[model samples]
Target chain A: MAKSKKNPLRWVRLDNAAKIYPAAMRKNWSNIYRQSMTLYEEIDTVVLKSALEVTVKRFPSIAARLRRGAFWFYLQQVEAAPEIQEEKSHPLCYMSEKEMSKYAFRVIAYRNRIAVEFFHSLTDGTGALIFLKNLVAEYLEQKHNISIPFEQGIIDRRVPPKSEELEDSFLKYAGRVPASRRDTNAWRVPGEKEPEGFIHVTCFKADVDSAIALAHKYGCTLTVFFSAVMMQALMNYQKELNPNTAKHKPIKLLIPINLRTLFKSETLRNFAMFTVPEIDARLGEYSFEEICKAVYHKMGYELTQKHMSAVIAKNVNDEKNILLRLVPLPLKNIVMKAVFDRSGERKSCLSMSNLGVVRLPEIMQKYVSRVDFILGVQATAPYNCGFLSYNGKVYINLTRNIRDAGLERHFFEILRDMGLEVTVESNRN
Target chain B: MYCVKCGVKLEDTEKICPLCETEVYHPIVKQEQVPPNYPPDKRPPAKKKTKIINGVVLFLIFIPLLTSLISDLQPDGAINWFGYVAGALTLAYIAFGLPMWFKRPNPAIFVPCFFAATVAYLKYIDFVTDGDWFLSFAFPAAMYFCLIISTLATLLFYLKRGKLYIWGGFVIALGFFFPLIELLLSLTFDLRFIGWSAYPFVVFGLLGGVLIYLAANRFARDAVQRRLFF
Candidate 1:
């Protein structure tokens, strides 16, 4: 692909969800995560570098660096390709402002996996996954000399990047009606945090068919079923960890909804929102079936076109407010930080994001064995669970900064007792 | 392999999950060999020094110097007032500008330079006005203050223990320095020795004694830590 003689100094406004990340990002908490794909063969650095070199140009938004404006933060196109480093032992390590001042994302090649960790301000999981898949495809094309055509989610390097690819989808889909952002404080997980700020990741592998069948038995989607299972696990642990407070506290699960499906957005930037399904244990002890029923109905109600529209509109409305728009970026950051501290992570005890089945092109699928999505632990919500299923296997990745493995242990045990075989793996040596 | 607890995919060689510390046990894939992808450990990268800030500082310093030189030259053929301006500018450069040149400048060295600069400026002012205060009052006052500060700084830099005791000693020394300042002032101005300096001497002397007494008690230190939440 030839470099277009277009104006190189291009910049774009941050999407609605992207705005919160820049303000909330701190030294101890970067609000970043690594979304990676492991190939069947060892990664060749030379080929991987060439792949990223050509692929980043196709997704112009991913190649940009974050810049501060008078009233807001924007992404400015960078001329130099980002350096792809060897994979570090810990994934999603805290990125200081100093490191972020250079670039918003980095590519790492280690063994069979090529991971891209992005500062959340740049894009959401869906957008990031698309970029990674394209990089891998490009790598395969360059290394193996294969003609793998661009598929639905992956970008084609032969064509120039369209303007719509950088569009702020929230503004496009925002309606006039505003939604309520008020939420009661959810039960926070109790545990000791690793002093050195270590994050523990535990991945569980289950048969995709069995998990789906279990969800089907409850007459709900896989995400709802998983969320219910997670909430139940939290309830059991809360009973053990804080027996006195367990009855009063509400167990809520955060599900980050992909807005693209509902809004028909082709924008590769952030376009996701969250809907929290909460269960108050004070009412009574909830059986697994009852919890599943509640989660299914609540998710169905909240994720409807009108209800989700109000959620999107509310955030866009906040951003579009005359007073908020007039405030400078620094002052806006203070407001956003306060709002996030009070309302963002406080609404949920744990977050469970399901990337769903990651379908690849037949040629690419053969080389890819596992697909994983990792969400970093937030300041308040110390534990977060991410799910990605591929090739008949479901991978559940639980990320926590706290020392206790009780949550993960309980979660998998529940699934195992329910007659589904569960296999666990960890990076801990 | 993946961590059954956190669900993060892991390299096969890891015996435990790096994130959660969950032991790795895959029933299906046992020790089929591959070298570790990551290195043994990670060391944080060195922070990049911003050279541009030094350039900006130099430019800012140049502006005031150029302005004073031009204003002084236009009014007179000689650099009479410009010498004073140069002295003040030199002092500013030594205090602020010189530190930007090195990553870490020893406070022991800079502190002495600051004293020397203050003394030089005082001498310059005296020479200009044909005053008689530099040798009697200004020099002694500046030297005593500089000596006290350098002593405290030396103790802080070199000592690994008894910081509180050192501070208590310095406070006591400061209490004693007040009367000497008064004595020098009276001698330089040809005035009678008034007991005015006694107020601060009593107050600081009492406070210093109390601090020394507290520093001598281990229980006091522990109590302070508990009370202060340090």
Candidate 2:
């Protein structure tokens, strides 16, 4: 049935993974990520705005603003869609607290590209990609006067949103046993920070087939291959700073895993957790092959249905605690902030999020030239990497708040040495 | 084009390699007409509407000032007690509201102006009451308080390091200042020295000594920082 336009405003409690974002966020910094698609032609703002109005009606959970209650933070449906904005000089600008309360996500257009930046509290990468695909589908249909099929990640805007799509899947799938939340502190890359909170993003475009072949040669998936290379780069960079091997710390990378792939769920909210794969540098220096092997086995051991459920149970059970539920939101924020500072970004030197291959219908694919995924740097950590494969090419985006490009240089040099051709572009002058 | 240093392919829009900062130079192959990845127009986000809120606050403050003026003048043809209310309101606005007009109000400038206005307010009160205490008691007292506060504000605002030392010195100075205040009262009003300033002097002196010690010892500072790590 078609939903009434004047229906009462709906609100939902933040999902298990999302609850910490509101508390962990600062006045100038928030957990935000951007996904953009470049088309063959320039974008018309009027048509994009109208398309957003229609697309938002279909995704109630995504089209809402963050609100605070006495006990928890919730997402309330906005009366109208936020205005379409012009793209800034860079993607993922600092989203202040007031801006998040007004709108948790923004649609930006520049030249022939359309980008959507989302506050991580609103959704994970999978959910954000789905939202972006649907929005692009709507924009194409309106601008080109061609109907797009509701296949792949695109959704039908005419249909009402299903209850399952807005569900907190973690609450439903958590197991009885909670996982042990223990992790060792990792080595952090230190550098001079950019003044005035400027973020630098560098994107490397490579042939996906060749990269996949290299991964196959290493007997591992593309994510594991990249993780190993990242670890090696970090190790090399740290070794230069501290020549003594005995003083070295562990190198860890937090890889975010999409839970929908393991569990049977169709929700668009946050259903993702992370696994930290680390290497102890105190033992000895590792070769490229050794790092790859270690990362592959660690991913295999952690990315399991049983272990994922245990992690979910640990998070959900904390939310279910009666004493925790009764704590006021202000007090909860302080506790969560302290806990986050202690164990959140401290366990991982950086995050590597791979969205895998993105497939669009043939009709929709003709107009889209390329797609890019960019993750914002962590709260305390300086670097983050996000990548996605689309249309025979993989776009790997490295974002940092620091001025030194040693990590990027080392990373790309490794890929170049491996016989992979990388095309580099950046927002820097 | 390729980066001469890193050997990675560079886009036409890139003048330098993002990874290594190497200049891209190709004599035969000219730069293409392709647009850059991000937009050239780097528009910053709009600032908040602080001026509007400041204006609203100004209007709110004006309400009572005008009301008191009218109420004081209605009973007679001349301004009677309106000066006292106006002086207090003006002092309050100068201390609080004046800073709102600036985006980054410097304490070095505002602090002195606030204390000067405070002294003026006291002078006004003395003038209206026809008291003989303006030059000897009120002026010196206000100037002394102003000098201490102004120096503290200026030092704290300008100096980035040695905060603990500055605070320690400030507290110790404040401890001695109480006795001076008591001495002034005794000279002006012919009152006996009760030695009441000794209590505050003792407390502030001990606190200032500890702060200075912590400032000198790096180990103690680090320990305090770790324990109070928010």
Candidate 1: lDDT of A402? 79
lDDT of 1 by residue, A333-427 (tens): 99999999998888899789998889888889878888888888987678998998989999888999876788887787688778877766655
**Can you list the residue pairs that collide in candidate 2?**
none
Off by over 4 Å in 2: A1-7, B41-230
lDDT of 1 by residue, B119-209 (tens): 9999999999899899999998899888888888888888868888888888888987889988998898888898888988888888887
Worst 10-residue lDDT window, candidate 2 chain A? A1-10
Task: Give all TM-scores, in the order shown.
Answer: 0.67, 0.71
Among all windows of 10 consecutive residues in model 1 chain B, the one with the lowest summed lDDT is B41-50
Model 2 residue B213 lDDT score: 91
Docking band of candidate 1: incorrect
